[model samples]
Target: MLKEKVYAADGDVHPDQQRIYGRGTELMDAEELVSLHVHDGKCILDLYLRKSKEISVLVIGMHGTRHKVAVDIFSTIKQLKKHLYWENNFCLEGKVLMFNGIHLDDSATFSNYNIDDKSVLYALEIPENHMNIKIRISTRDITSVFLSKSETIKNLKLMIRQHTFIPVDQQELTLHDTVLEDNKTLFEYFQDQEDGQILTLSLIHHIRISLTVCINMFKSSDYVVQSVSLLGSDTIEMLTQIVYQRVFILPKQQQLKKNGQILEHSKTLSKSNLTNGDIIFVDILPLCKITINLGEGHKPITVEILPNDTISEVKDHIQKESGILMNNRCLLHEGAVLEDHKSVDDYDIKDGSILFLSQRPPELVTLTFQRTSGEVSELKFNPRDPVSVQSTIQNIIKGENESASKSHVYECKQF
Candidate 1:
């Protein structure tokens, strides 16, 4: 059976203390317990809905406790507080009620709640329509505005424009690839999903002009160029995606720009001011593509590394795929050892440059063990451990034998 270690942190302290939690361990003043079950020889964590039962709910107002009610799956909020006369008892009437963290509507039932297996129910006080959906415009300007999901896209645009000063006409709201219509409600788009889902907004500006542009790839004086028909109304972001698709680049790795200015997805192509037949440079990152030459006979492996990643991370990734240890390998860029602390940009490495990967001399050790049939097995240790020939069983099990002087060598093999 597979065993796994689980860790949890205590949030009550200034510096949060992390602790490994075992199966069936109680958590946070015994409020919850960690449970586990084995599936296909792997331990799976079980923390939800072991059993279900009716739970007591405490409903509160802005002032104080309004009602203490018992609720079950079939019970509705309307049934619990129907007895209170809101016109006379204005204290209880105006005060909005909440269950757990969600604001409760009159139609909201206990079935809507995500209940615990312990039959515990929670209700609290919050302002009316407190549940709000956050809308994010773009990663560059990540200022998020929250409003009720019941609000229409038109109202959402107005709210966002009020804060950003971006004209409502330029705003384009989208969920995945589908565009949100101004008349449609936000809840109508995400009601099928969970409540309070995040909606991404894309801003598009319309302009009128037709231009044919040529995209060229120049590497070591060799060129591969393609011509694309573009409109002034097309967004720079959209053009970036189209160019990347045509160039056979994965969407995530596509970084295209002209001049020194990185293209913003929300801006129109015309705003960047490119007339007909203007040349837009594709390679924005200095060290976008690199070739790692692994000595003689082995074909050179080429990879694309992100600009943000350090030299050490790239080396580690190479080690995983090539079965070469990071400590045993040294990366030489133009005959100089690359430092782990510096980024790829610091070395002035460019696309298609060859980086040499030189390996250190390996250390070998001799291991000897005896089988149940009274036959001795001995061999020089190799890094690639295979079953039957593996060193794990001999190192872990056979190493426990007190006769190390007769069966084991003092030399350690570098893995």
Candidate 2:
């Protein structure tokens, strides 16, 4: 670590001055002094013969990269950092240099640890064997790519395919104008350069598609012709949506038809014999699903109902399956009583809605009948029954008229 040279004597000193026993520096070892260069036909010693100062040590970087550097054995660890930082503009600013698994202090000299020429000092934060690189996909995707020096470009492509959803065959990655080869690694590509400048490559992708068909669709006067394009394998269900978006018509109100024949939604465009530029008419018939909860503890049922089905028809379905009487069934949704005359759509009931079913026992209705002689009679009947009170009174009056006629016949014979 000594910057100043040791003087044998001041001016033209005697050889006896160099051999000043027990009066000068301690003692010099024979192997300590290393021949640096031959200058002016004279030998020059770079390291003085003393302690570990004459030994050179190896420096290792992070990521398993190694650099065999010759450094002053007695030099402080901070001084060794200067040589590394200046070498090819490399940085060791935040790296913790460790010697024999112990962190080397900047203030501590190499001699403090009794280091030798075979000793290795490591910059624990520097990358060496393998590195983590960033990849910028053209789809505005940023992904992390991990690789060792031995990993091939094919492995990298596989990893990219897994993360970015881009097929390896479709991907043609390029760094500047250089197209990467699947057989070679990045280390082989940039082996000459100072450890492959922190890899950040831009990935390019190309997508391929086959045939597409354009169709003409009409919904009443709101017509949209040749505005939608689709593949031949597409279903009529997809066309319904395209018609709705183009013509501002609801999909539920749409029924695709060609030449007066209805097109089933499950059938594909090719299966329906539809070709490019074919015109299809849209019919208005919307259907939806409704859930009927048959009271508590009963499994709910789903019925596919059309716009024409009223609340009474819905009850009929429940009655057929649940055996609950039509009159006893009381259907309600969101606290509003369902009317027999009103359709489910009229109640603003959307598709896949739940309706509660509870029982309402029938009540009796009383009918009073008064005769011309001031005689009164009360007749009771269930209003929900098949026969009405008015019908019962009419039957009773017909019997009375017949009896009066018979009484008139008896009076003609005796009175």
Estimated TM-score per prediction?
Answer: 0.28, 0.23
Considering summed lDDT, which 10 consecutive residues are worst modelled in model 2?
406-415
Model 2, 1-415: lDDT tens per residue?
Answer: 1121234334332211232112233222111111222235454334223433456677777767776667776577777788777873557775667665444556545664556777887776634655445566543324444456677878787876654566676565677758788899867876653432356677755332121222334324554444455555567888878766666656656666788898888887667876644667666665678898887788988776667678998888777877778775688899888888998779888788888887764677766665444555666676667667567655546545443542221111111
**Which candidate wins on lDDT?**
2
- Candidate 2 clashes between residue pairs 3 or more apart in a chain or in different chains: 62-126, 62-127, 62-128, 63-128, 63-129, 64-128, 64-129, 65-128
- Write one digit per residue (lDDT tens) for candidate 1, span 300-367: 78777776568898897677667667786778988798878887788887778788988744455566
Off-target runs (Cα >4 Å) in candidate 1 are 1-212, 217-238, 247-313, 316-320, 323-335, 340-415
Candidates' C-alpha lDDT? 0.54, 0.60
